[model samples]
Target: MKHARIGHQSIPRWAYLLFIVLAVFVLYRIFQHRAEVAKASQPPVRPVLVAKVITKDVPLYLDEIGTCSAYETVQVQAQVSGQIIARHFQDGADVKQGDLLFTIDPRQYQAALDQAQGQLGQVKAQLGLDRITLKRQQELRARNVTSPQDLDVAQGTVNSDEAKVKSAEAAVAAAQVNLDFCNIRSPINGRAGLRLVDVGNIVSGGNAGGGGAVLLTIQGLDPIYTDFTVAETDLALVRRYLGGPNVKVQTDLSDGSIPPRLGDLYFIDNAVQPGAGTVKARAITPNPDRALWPSEFVRVRFILDVLKDAQLVPSQAVQISQSGPFVFVVKPDNTVDLRPVKPGQHQEGDMTVIENGLKPGETIVITGQLALSPGAKVDPKPYDAGNPKSDRQVAAKGAM
Candidate 1:
């Protein structure tokens, strides 16, 4: 018997290809799932930069914006009216006290002086003649040759001549004073400003009301004054150490091209400004090089006291959370702990003064706190204060 023909059934090429693709996908998924499980089982060890908490003396200070002012400002004006014959100093020259600055025409004043002197001489001659006449009249009266009324007249004439002589002498003194006024001199040692009047320019004399054509302006630059203000809330603290030995001020230009100038606190306004709610204060700083100029803006650091043995840390080490400020402290086992801290003023060199909750010799994380949690292991690295890039990197991470 013929058996039923056995039919050969073959799978399609596309179907086999599909099966192989599915098997490969399943194997890949299995490997990926195992990798994820392994990753979840082990915690990541983060790398961080850290610094040691230090102890040092820090200044208790108030920072403020201030302006430089001349210790003395003078608007020089003519004291006697005349044509300016010559200028003794150039514009913007440095002058000492009694240095001649200008010369006015002195011809008229000299002529007036000569006339006054001539009048004085005439009066003196007349007084001498009258005195001789009085003596002769007294002799005649003694001989009974002249009347008493004549002698009295002679004495009155001599007295009148003496009065005239005194009047002439006063006029002569007045003329001499006017002559001296023709030469204008600097009253103080200072730097002169631009000349307002040129030679041959006639300037009017200063009046009793102190108004006149201002010839020049002079400003005293050495030992300049820096004017600043303190907030009303801080006034009490400033007043407590206003005149104390530890109280001092340091002024620096905003550009910081020049070094800071140390000074003494000079003045404090008695009352606060009504609108500003700040009390004005002044500091006298030595500016021997004349580096400080009038109306220049500067930064003022009013140092009240010094804190001895204060704990300090890198400013970037301090982190702010919802609770408050905290720092990540590294332990001996390379683990970190979150510590709450009371931070004080930020001092020079990017340092923060820790008023509470930190001790000297402790290590705190300065950077890489973004990836850390409490009790997390870390790959520690030393903080480099001198490296500016480290600060910028920390700032960027902290910002994130």
Candidate 2:
């Protein structure tokens, strides 16, 4: 029985070729996806702003939070008690020494002075008459017309009257002083604050109470004092460099319109503060415009010395981490090396002094540090702080 001869179905060469092509295409796609992922994993070349580490003479300054204090603060008060008759000066006026500030009731003082003067005149007349009588008595005694006792009595009367004249003179002088005090004058050259006692108010004098009621508050403005502190640990360093010549202090006022003022360091506390571990320091600065006020907070920069040929870089290049301050240094091949640095004084122009871990003429990454890692390649661009457009562009990139 021939089973109708079993026959085998064969696949066409074109179909087999098609299958091979599909398998090869799927494998290629898998490998291509892998290759793309690997490429994506590698970091791209970053564009960064760079600056050269410069060697120049940099003024070393210590910055501290400080306060502007008046050189002298005076509470203007009356020396003699009286009713305030008039206010001579306006509130918050700039006053000079001996400037009349207020006037008390001078009528009573004037009357007292007049009475004292009259008393003094009366005493003088009595003394004059006594002298005449004493001379006549002495002549009589010499000529035996009067007894010795009588002459002695006349001389004693003359002496007693002379004593009375002296007493009256002192009283008159004291009265004049009281009258002068009725016109209160500024004791210091300063700017006056609000009027404490208005016209028609009866104020006590210095003799009335421990201190007279404060009529006005005045604070010296020019050559003002700025009080700041330095950490106790830095005392030695501060003292060492402070001894150098041309050391100046700069004060940053709260008002931005005014430039930083130059001052001289005049005082240092004898002892460090107990708990804070800081030492009080003071500077005297001329405030001709009265820009600084008493108790106004300010920033004080004490320039101890100028470091010559120091390595410096833009301040933004320095970054802080858990270890310490570090900076990304760009190499010649555009690769960045994360370098730990010892940052020193920061200049007013955004330049910082690097004490270590950097050298002069070395390029440092300043702006694009956010996109950097160790050994990563970067496209270094020169950072020009003067260019406003470049700043905007950098800011834009940072936001992205």
Candidate 3:
């Protein structure tokens, strides 16, 4: 009505103040969000530890289970049958070749030898008399004092006597050999097993066809053998490098408490096993200390060949993703690039061989990979593998 109702009514001062406060609060939130977005859009810089790839020759090896065996096993037995008069070696003693192990009663053999010698002596005397008779008969025949038949008979007797003497000499030699066999000696340098027959036991010595009742067993321990098997599928590769000088082998106790023993491949079976489809192989290891025992199970590794100038990296540096094995490489510009790699053999003590996608002297991120992305800026630091504290921390973080 009056003056068009004064179009506007007067607002409270507190209301104006409240409107201003609300507007200011909204504007401040908008600015903070924009700032955060801008910061996020920029590349993220993460601190990480890096290591350099090394170049060296690394051996390729195949690992399998094996058994330790004596290189040579001999069954000790007496060669002649007689009473075991004495035993010269104790059970389980180390013996050398030709060492006397047992002594059999040689009196009978000696008597036989004496009788043979006497027989040989008698034959020789008879042969001498026959030779004189033949010569006298020949001279008498030449003088026409004796008939040709007499000379012929004398010659025949001399020939017969010579044959008898030869037979008697052979008998003496046989008797001598039997006497020598009475003294049982070690056939090889090795450790003897338990005595099968004690002293005073009459042992059958002659070839009983069953090795004469095994008196003892001797096993050559030094230069021991580790017999193992490999899959037939890998036979081609194994055969290729079989005789190569670079090929090597190692073995360790199955328990893994002792250090590995170094050796070389010595034998390969002519054919693969029919049922198992595995090829038998053996390695000879120098065991001067007798560290390896017969029939002991062990872990065997066959080193096929060495890759010269191959790239090596820390084992932890290799990461597995959907695209396969990859690693985060630290570029010279302090940026990390995700790279795919072809990983080869993984060696002991945390070392890995990279077949491709890496080069020697290149840097790789070893730790702090959780926060990394392709082309992300990084604050790289040299990784000190000798530092135990950091290793422990990394291990803890990985567990988490």
Candidate 3 lDDT by residue in tens digits, 1-400 = 7655565445667999999999999999999999999998996577778889998888888989999999999998788888999999999888999999999999999999999999999999999999999999999999999999999999999999999999999999999999998889999998999989999999886455555757999999998999999999999998898889888889898788878988988988999899999999999987887878999999998999988887899888999999899999998899989999999888776789999999789899888887678898887777888895885565445334
Angstrom error of the Cα, residue 227, model 2: value is 2.2
Which ten-residue region of model 1 has the weakest summed lDDT? 1-10
Better of 1 and 3 by lDDT: 1
Local accuracy of candidate 1 as per-residue lDDT tens digits, 243-353: 778898999998899999999999989999999999999999999999999999999999999899999998988999999999999999999999999999999888999
TM-score winner among the candidates? 3
Count of backbone collisions in candidate 3: 2
- Residue pairs with backbone overlap in model 3: 80-205, 81-205
What's the lDDT for all of these models? 0.91, 0.87, 0.89
The true-versus-predicted C-alpha distance at residue 268 of model 1, in Å, is 2.1
352-387: candidate 2 lDDT, tens digit per residue: 889999988889887877767899988778888888
What TM-score, over all chains together, does every model reach?
0.75, 0.72, 0.81
Q: Give the range where candidate 3 is weakest over 10 consecutive residues by summed lDDT.
A: 391-400
Error of 2 at 42 (Å): 17
TM-score of 2: 0.72
